[model samples]
Target: MAKRNRKKNQAGFVFPAPLAVVLVVLAGFSLVYVCLKAKTEALGQEIKALESRSVQLRQDVVREQCEWASRLSPASMEQALKAHGLVMTWPGREQIVRMRADGTIDSSVIPEVRPPARYARVDRVVMND
Candidate 1:
């Protein structure tokens, strides 16, 4: 038995192992960079959308406050009462007694503003002669 002489291989020069590894690593880094860039852009869009939503919510709050204030106006309250068929007559000039600077309607009447229950209660005494 005898081994036959093979012809010289004609394959082109192959890249060295370390160069191939470096190229693969560079490609991987480029791919990671592209993925990170895309993620950042997506986050930016989300932030923009949230900011617009917050602005809309603030505007809605302001609109609601304005509506509440208008509804609470004296004219609006009177209009609502009239719509409900309720007639309230103002007091006659003779019936309306002006309060004194000392918060007394008369010797027997003393007006007081009470604090909420969470505070300590204090009894007020007014001496009348």
Candidate 2:
């Protein structure tokens, strides 16, 4: 083929090397930023999950407390004790004696805070003279 009307091919655009390098660096920085953002979002989700678990545990504790209160109600405890043939009564003034306060435990008749084995097992110990 004969080259006809070939004046010049100087119509192409030339990109600057330093500007291209800067654009490449900017692209690298953008990639690093995107990675960090993704990691941050994942951590946020984990935090939300932990918070939900904490809330659920707190709710469970509250429910347990309400159940415990219901079980420990006066009516229920009295009924249970009566059904078990347990009689719990306060001690008379004569049954309680004061200590000498001389670093000695005064006890002529020790009061029983715990019910009999047939009833509930109380955690309190009553010391009286």
Candidate 3:
């Protein structure tokens, strides 16, 4: 009876250690799959957000171009200049200066006809009491 029991136990019986190892391997694979799925979903959400932001940026660019177009019209420019109280006039022949290809003034211009300085000296009056 003892010999028969030993033969039955050793014949085609599954061991707990191999079964546990297989279960652990399957669990590890499942964990890795879940992690990859989560990462893919995160990347998809980021792509969607960036696409929306790009669309908004394109709309903003269109709006700015339209605004600039209106601002750049001749009438609009004239209005702006008038608002700033500036007077535009044609320069006289003596006031006009020509430039050469080398960036020097043309020899035909008189040396005595120098353009007005950007900032002139202001004379101050002093009162001695």
Candidate 4:
């Protein structure tokens, strides 16, 4: 009877060792899962902040472009040109003169202006090659 009782106690001890090993594995896995969750949340917050900053920069660019356009109207451009002693002149007609390589000259008539200017009835000349 003493021998049988000793064997039964040894069997119970063997079962608890495996159960302890399983608990240790489960604890390690739980720690890893928690770490990954925290890292993912931090990365998501960073992405949101960067996106908000990008949107604000885009809005600032659009506002600056509109302000510049409002200040640089046609009248302002004309005034600035005149301040530099530069005047816009329109050509009425054109006469093309071509010179040959052998010192010969050939002349032809070309209509350089079609429609007149907006405010002034002067003809604008456009040269094309």
Number of the top-ranking candidate, with TM-score as the measure: 1
Model 1 ranges with Cα > 4 A deviation: 1-12, 89-129
Compose the digit string of candidate 3's lDDT tens values, residues 4-108.
Answer: 666566657576898899999999999999999999999999999999999999999999999999999988998999998765667767777788899988978
Give the worst 10-residue stretch by lDDT in candidate 4: 89-98
Off by over 4 Å in 3: 1-15, 91-129
lDDT of 4 by residue, 15-71 (tens): 476788999999899989899989988999998998998999999999999888866
- The CA-based lDDT of model 1 is what? 0.81
Cα lDDT listed for each candidate: 0.81, 0.83, 0.84, 0.75
Clashing pairs in model 2, backbone N/Cα/C closer than 3 A: 97-129
- The lowest-lDDT stretch of 10 consecutive residues in candidate 2 is 110-119
Task: Report the CA-based lDDT of candidate 2 relative to the real structure.
Answer: 0.83
Q: Considering lDDT, which of the candidate structures 1 and 3 is the better prediction for this target?
A: 3
Q: Work out the TM-score per prediction.
A: 0.60, 0.51, 0.56, 0.48
Query: Which tens-of-lDDT digit does each residue in 1-129 have in candidate 1?
Result: 766545444465767999999999999999999999999999999999999999999999999999999999999999999998776777544445668899767744433444533424568878794
The per-residue C-alpha lDDT of model 3 at residue 5 equals 66
Model 1 is weakest, by summed lDDT over 10 consecutive residues, at 110-119
Better of 2 and 4 by lDDT: 2
